[model samples]
Target: MNQPSPKRRGRFITLEGGEGAGKSTQVEGLKRFLEDQGIALVTTREPGGTPVAEAIRGLLLSRDHPAMHPDTELLLMFAARAEHLRTLILPALEAGRWVLCDRFTDATYAYQGGGRGVDPARIAALEVWVQGPVRPDLTLLLDMDVKTGLARARGRSEADRFEQEAVEFFERVREAYLERARSEPARYRIIDASRSVEAVAGDLQQAVSSLMGTGQGT
Candidate 1:
């Protein structure tokens, strides 16, 4: 009698936040902890997870290219996202490896729809097209005030195009993230990023562990 192989159970985890919300730090910290615990993991960021996406990232970062339209920016983001998912993320998940992504579709909705004033309907349509059934199993929304976040961002480097937006833009982006978090409470966890780095990391770890049904001790 022929027997079927065991199914691979893959998990998708995402970190979402406005610029300078310490999402990168938290994601790296979580990845390290997960790796130390011998969890199969692959960490990658959006807009550059694959070669095609990397090319789109170059355009997004090149700020001096006079007046990139919001619609253009939105499409470009999703274009990169589609390629990233098809080439890197989907394959990793199918292989039963946990994927830790820096940002995902929520970022596009917040940044383009909320921050850049694109129509939500337009963003929603794009999301449906690019994402389909592939969505993050858990999204860690790093919450913080826009002023503090921008201050931290400014200290890091000269602000990029998105980072250089007005404070109000980022505020709206934060609201959008929170709204999404509230709407999908089952899949979203809000972490207070305003706290100390260690505190924030602890919250992040707890949220992830809870989602995975693992007791929190790390």
Candidate 2:
């Protein structure tokens, strides 16, 4: 008899939030936790992961390019995402390695569609064109007050292009994130980022445990 083939696909998890939601820290913690559970995983960030995508990230975040058109920004984002998914995310999943991405296309909807006033229909089209059937199995939305999040973000580092936007811009971004979460509660977990780090980690742990229990057979 032929030996059974090992699982060739793995879960895709994405972390999303406005500035200063502490996604990086949570990502690290989650990595260790998932490893402890004996899961093969890859950790990466959007507009990053691959060299070509990282170059696009630099262009997208550069404060010097304040005059860049919204459409240009949106297109650069998708270009980088296309590279990220094709080069890094997809291959890992095919090898049965769970992918924990810092941000994904949802950020495009929140940032470009809500913050920059791009049409959601246009973004949806790009998402389908670039990603095809691939989508995050889980998205952790670190929700927080725009003012508090911005203050934390500014204190940590100089504002990037998106970070430099006014409070109103971030508010819209937050709203967009929440709206998406509400619309897809099954796939999204809205974490209240206003809590202490320990508390937030507890929530994350619970969410991860629940996902593992579900055993989606990825």
Candidate 3:
């Protein structure tokens, strides 16, 4: 009788931060570092990834709509997340590829729950529903002062819906992320992002190494 090899579940890692906090940049750098070490990986993002979710992402990010209600935005984000998880995230985790996600349910908590003044309980419930058992094993939060991050974000052309938010809005969102990180220390690593990109990347590598039990091999 031939027995199958045990399934190798992948570690789910997510990068979270306010707009312009350099999440995309760092994710790319970290991915390169991890690959250099010979670790197989899959990189993806929420409110996207799946075809349906990417369509939802368009609605969520569309700057053409000025009157989009907060509740509507929240629901849309969750809807996109649900599709992304079922079609993309879950499969990647089950296939033994380390999944590096750009953002996830935490963004809903920070952006809509904290930034748009939505009810936290609802946000929590939606997260539980959408993400279920496949939550990130580690979430790297790129922490930077709102003013600085926003300035960096603003320098980039075409502010997204979140970037269009007021500084006070993002301040609350930042607080929300910090609050979550504080409450869930085992799952969240806060990286000070005000430093130079190389320094932040160095710090990020260290954090990821600690979480994953070795430098991705490099």
Top lDDT model: 2
Candidate 1 lDDT over residue span 1-218, tens digit each:
22212232567899999889998777778998887777789999986788899899889977785489888998899889988887788777778788899989989888887788888899888777776656788899999999999999899888787776788889999998998899999899998899999999988888877656442211
> Of models 1 and 2, which has the larger TM-score?
2
For each of the candidates, give the backbone clash count: 0, 0, 0
What lDDT is obtained when candidate 3 is compared to the true structure?
0.82
Better of 2 and 3 by lDDT: 2
TM-score against native, each model: 0.91, 0.94, 0.91
Predicted candidate 3 versus true structure: per-residue lDDT over 2-121, tens digit per residue: 222223377778999987899888888999988887777889987798889999998888888868998899999988887777677767767767889898888888988888889999
CA shift of 195, model 3, Å = 0.8
TM-score of 2: 0.94
Best by TM-score: 2
Prediction RMSDs, each to the true structure: 5.1, 4.5, 4.8
Candidate 3, number of clashes: 0
lDDT score of residue 108 within candidate 2: 95
lDDT of each: 0.83, 0.88, 0.82
TM-score of 1: 0.91
Rank order (by lDDT, best first):
2, 1, 3
